[model samples]
Target: MSSRTLPLLFINLGGEMLYILDQRLRAQNIPTDKAKKVMNDIITTMFNKKFLEELFKPQELYSKKALRTVFDRLAHASIMRLNQASMDKLYDLMTMAFKYQVLLCPRPKDLLLVSFNHMDAIKDFVRDAPSILNQVDETYRQLIEMYTALSGGEFQLIRQTLLVFFQDMHIRVSIFLKDKVQNSNGRFVLPTSGPVPCGTQIPGMIRMFSCTGEEVRRLQFPSGGGYTGALREGSFQMFGERVIKLGTNMYSVSRPVETHMSGTAKNSAQHRPAHQQC
Candidate 1:
């Protein structure tokens, strides 16, 4: 925020995690065209000559004109250095770049990032019919937060982003559970009833997918709610030791009809109830 911490925060933005994030985001199939536009617009509007003039006004430590000149120099150097330093950190750098530019220039204008109207922005972004809408929303939501924080606005929760994250995770967990069921090799049993609530599954599911975070080895599900580990014939399989046998009383490894049919045929041939024997 202040001049002192600007470069350090820049280091964080441009540090090791930057490459990892870029690789993951780039590998994801989510469309980046809309997000790129948002990025470009914010950069263009926030960094233009007029905005710089408004931002850098008279300061006690430095003259307004002098401050602007210093900021221009910093801006030019920082922008060039950061851009050349790491492509992965470009967008994150831009968010802070705009903020730094404004503060150094000393302006009263607000940079609008996340707002209540963002729902419409999200709607427009989703209008293109991206298959993974939640992931896309997640990307946008995250982008907005970084930029929003740059402007010093407190972040707000977007429910849709959370919901989409959960849904996508459910699909992935379901696929894994299906494979587990298939591999169970008949020893595996699924509960016929009693499914865990929709939202409750999120925690355990997150734990399952992400174990690298803090204290991952111990996974705890709350008392009242739980997720069934498997789904069969439209019913979710609750995790348990009990297996229900609900079919016929008689169990046959091979064929039940053949056992009776062979005896019946021999008797019928001898008795020659003739009409039906053949």
Candidate 2:
């Protein structure tokens, strides 16, 4: 294999170490036929370094001598790169660590590096124009479902994964929104005291906040009602509105009103607050 391929191979191997061995790796720049050859070379390098010795060492006695020896050896070569076999072993160890909450092994940076490397293929796959939109949409849908599932099932790992997932999605959405906004002439204004005509496309700023569970309530006044005057008061009321829960903590919709009034009283008050007060 060409020397140029070695870096990519290492990256791919490191990615595999992160426990994200998905089909996306097939989309990498390296041709499918050469992946195994590159992986084998990496494996050979890891094996020569005796990296697997510590992993295989006996833990039955847990003596200070054994612990000190292991620590000394690790201190000497703590940051060695892995070959395919070692990477596979690392993956197994990580899974077990997460499953059993084992003591510190790999650092968080190591795990994050592996995750980014593994995602390289997915990034490349979605970069293609034909699949970009579909991939982005599907990713968002998957995130929502994953969030709901993790929240309901109390899966800690899934919850942690969702945190990463949402963070990545937020970056993607920011990029997408910037591009969309730059191409359009209009600006986003948070709706105040009026009905948005049906079919009004929601802006990205609103959508981003909505996805993160921010409550957006729209209030409308009757025809011949004061617009600008009511708007100033309505804006204040918006801040105090109670968020209405729709279904089981998964969905919610809020309606803003003055704190003292019921929905009907609030609606009526909006039209004739002075008369009601009188």
Ten-residue segment with the worst summed lDDT in candidate 2? 242-251
Q: Positional deviation of 271 in candidate 1, in angstroms?
A: 79
Task: Report residue 130 deviation for candidate 1 (angstroms).
Answer: 3.6
For each candidate, what is the lDDT?
Answer: 0.28, 0.27
Best candidate, TM-score: 2
Model 2: per-residue lDDT, tens digit, 1-278? 11121222222333233222112122233343333323333223323324433322322222334433432232122222233443333443222222211111022212222223233333333343334434333433432332223232243332244233222211111211343521232222222333322223322222223666787655443444222321111111102211111001100123211111123322332343231211
Using Cα atoms with residue i matched to residue i, what is each candidate's TM-score against the true structure? 0.16, 0.19
Per-residue lDDT of candidate 1, residues 1-278 (tens digit): 13222222222222212222222223332235522332223233323455434333322233324433433343222111222223223332222322222222111211121121222233333455444344334433433444434432221122222222222221111222344631233222333335432223323432433455554445665544343643222111111211221111111222111011123322322343222211
- Steric clashes per prediction: 3, 0
Candidate 2 structure, TM-score to reference:
0.19
